[model samples]
Target: MKAVQYQNFGGPEVLEVVDIPDPKMFADLVLVRIEAAALNPADLAFQSGAADPLVDSLFPVTPGWDLAGVVEQIGVATAGFQPGDEVIGFVRGQAMHYGTYAERISAEPRQLVRKPRNLSWAQAAGLPLAGLTAYQAIVHGLKVTAGDTVLVHGAAGGVGHLAVQIAIAQGARVLGTGSAASQAFIGSLGAIPVRYGDELVDEVLKIAPVGVDAVLDTAGRGSLSTTQALAAVGARVASITRSSTEYEGAIDVYARLDGDDLTRLVELAEEGKLTVHVDSAFPLGQAAEAQRVLAGGHVRGKIVLEIREEV
Candidate 1:
């Protein structure tokens, strides 16, 4: 199998595609022939060694987590999936290695979900990590409910855009923050678009009046700091980018691989309540270029690597 791997930590420059031996299947893991892989900011952080202190690294690391693929082989102990099943997964583990960047990956059953029939491979590939983060933050962390006014920072971004839609799906009135360029895109997701910067608080207040019922900050840059001023009394707050200690009451969320959670996202997508937008896609050989594009920032949605033409 051909895979993208980096022997040392650096920027996109460190990545290289090489022919590697196929991964061996463990008793409890399913082997997937990857069709697409999505790039995330964490992929950049992990490749740059910024996440070094938190996770151990295996040299020649294959950097990716979000994947959409077809099952090529099933483990003896894995029963839910069978050969030829189409699947999507967040393949993270205790260490940085054996990622989904390759043509094949062996994943635990709990990390895999049946890909939504309505989504293409690229869209499905982009759903796992970002979708999980947004779903967990808005639905679980903030507990957004019908009639509530929710505020989402970076509303047009990869995670933020999904967060906006997820909040709306939960029946919350959403106020999403983004740049002038994104206002239309933000509003299209069924949220009231609020511009970023000095007037953000005013913009949100103009719509919510008494302040938002919950705030989800997907864009860091001191976004959590505004929760005190933008949220209503007793409002919940969650941040995927900031630290819990950075803001007194905000919950700092890290996305986890949960089969149940991914399945719910798939249902949302199937029901047309959630959408995964792929801003761009590159062939697997261009993994490094894809990372650079994501690192450049301001991406409207997920960037994917098309591993197979049929995808």
Candidate 2:
């Protein structure tokens, strides 16, 4: 099998396309014939050694976490899946030993769910990590409800786009912050678009004078503090990008991608309540270029690597 891997972590240049032995399925896992995979900030963080502490425990790593593929073989103990079943999941943590930037991957049965029939491989490939992150942040962490006003930062990026939609689906009145360029796109997701700049707080105040019910900060910088300032008293606020810090009154949440949460995201995608946006894609061999695009950090949605020809 061919994979993009780095023997030593350094920069994106360290990632190389190489031929490696195909993965062997272990009991309670399934061997998937990789169709497509998506790039996450974690992938770049792992490749550039910025996430060294997180990667040290999972080394000689293939960088991707989200994958959409078909089951080519099933391990003896794996149930609810069989050869040729199309599935998608967050392959990290459970299949951390074998990353998604490969021709094949062996993932734990619990990590995957059937890919939505309505989506193409490229779209399905975009879902796992980002979709689950947004779902968990809004539906699980903040517990948003109808008529609640929710704020999302980086509202046009991969996770942010989905976060906006998911909040709307939950019946919350949504407001999203992005660059001036993404206003129309953010508006399409049913969110009132707020251009992020010096007057971000002013713009938000104009929209919700009483403050918002919840805020999900996808842009890690100092947006958490901004979210804190605009939050209602006892409001729920979470950051998928940054670690929690000393914030006076807001509830801080750290996004953790869990199997059960991924399952619910898959169900939502299948039910048309959720959507995954693919901003760009590269072939498996162009893993370096994929990392380059991801590093730019202004993508409207997910960047994917097409690992194999569509079935």
Candidate 3:
């Protein structure tokens, strides 16, 4: 089997596709033949040694967390998944090491979610991490509901786009912030688009005279003041990028892997209520190019590495 590995933390140039031994099936874990993998900003940070404090690295590292694959083998203890079942997984753990950017991966049953029939392998590959973050932040952290006005910062980016859709699905009247280039894309997701910057607060206030019921900030350029000013009298605020308490009165969210949560996201995608945009895709061995695309930033959705044909 072939996998992308980096011996030292540095740039995308460090990524190498090498022939490695197939992963051994561990107890209580299922083995999957990976079809596709998606790259995230955290993958770049960890590979470049920037996430050193948050992620303890084990060298000869394979850097990826989002995967769409088919079950090749199931552990004796694992239930609910059988061989040949199509599945998606976040594959994140307490430590960084072996991952999904390979021909094969072993995952715990708790990490598995049945893929929706409507999604292609590329779309399913993009959903796990970004979808999970948006789900946790908007649905759990902010408590957005029908008739509420919600604002999503960085609404054109990966997680922000999903957050916008989830808020709309919950029946909230949403106002999303993005650059001029992304305003139309933001509005297409059923939200009022507000170009972010000096005019963010004003645009939001113009759309909702009473202010927004909740604010989700994915752009961490000190947007606390804007969110505070745009908040309704008693609004919940959350930020995925700024997890520090220094931000004040904001719930700093970190995405966690939950099978149940992914299942709901899959249901929405299958029902055509949510969308996962893939900006570009590279072949499996071209993992370096995929990272380069993600590092460029402002991609409409996700960057995926298509490893093999989906069964």
Top model by TM-score, which number?
1
Tell how far residue 101 is off in model 2, in angstroms: 0.4
Comparing 1 with 3 on lDDT, the higher-scoring candidate is 1
> What do the candidate models score in CA lDDT, each in turn?
0.90, 0.83, 0.87
Give TM-scores for every candidate, taking all chains together and pairing residue i with residue i.
0.97, 0.93, 0.96
Clashes of 3: 0
Instruction: State the displacement of the C-alpha of residue 154, model 1, in Å, after optimal TM-score superposition.
Output: 0.5
lDDT of 3 by residue, 1-311 (tens): 98999999998999998888888887689999999998999899899998888779998999999999999998888888999999999898778889888989999888889987888899899999999999999889988888899888888888989999999999998888888999899888888998868877887788888888888888777766666677888888899997435346789898998878899999999889898888899998899988888888888878899997324
Report each candidate's C-alpha RMSD, comma-separated, in the order given. 1.6, 2.2, 1.8
lDDT computed for candidate 2: 0.83
Q: How close is candidate 3 to the true structure, as a TM-score?
A: 0.96
Better of 2 and 3 by lDDT: 3
Report the lDDT tens digits of candidate 1 across residue range 1-311: 88999999999999998988889988998999999999999999888999899899999899999999999998788899999999999999899988988899988988898999999999999999999999999988989889989888899899999999999999999988888999999989999999888987887778887988898888888877777787788888889996555568888888987778899999999999999888999999999889889988889989999996323
| lDDT for residue 278 in candidate 1, whole number 0-100 | 87
Pairs that collide in candidate 3 are none
Predicted candidate 1: what Cα RMSD to the true structure?
Answer: 1.6
lDDT of 1 at 303: 97
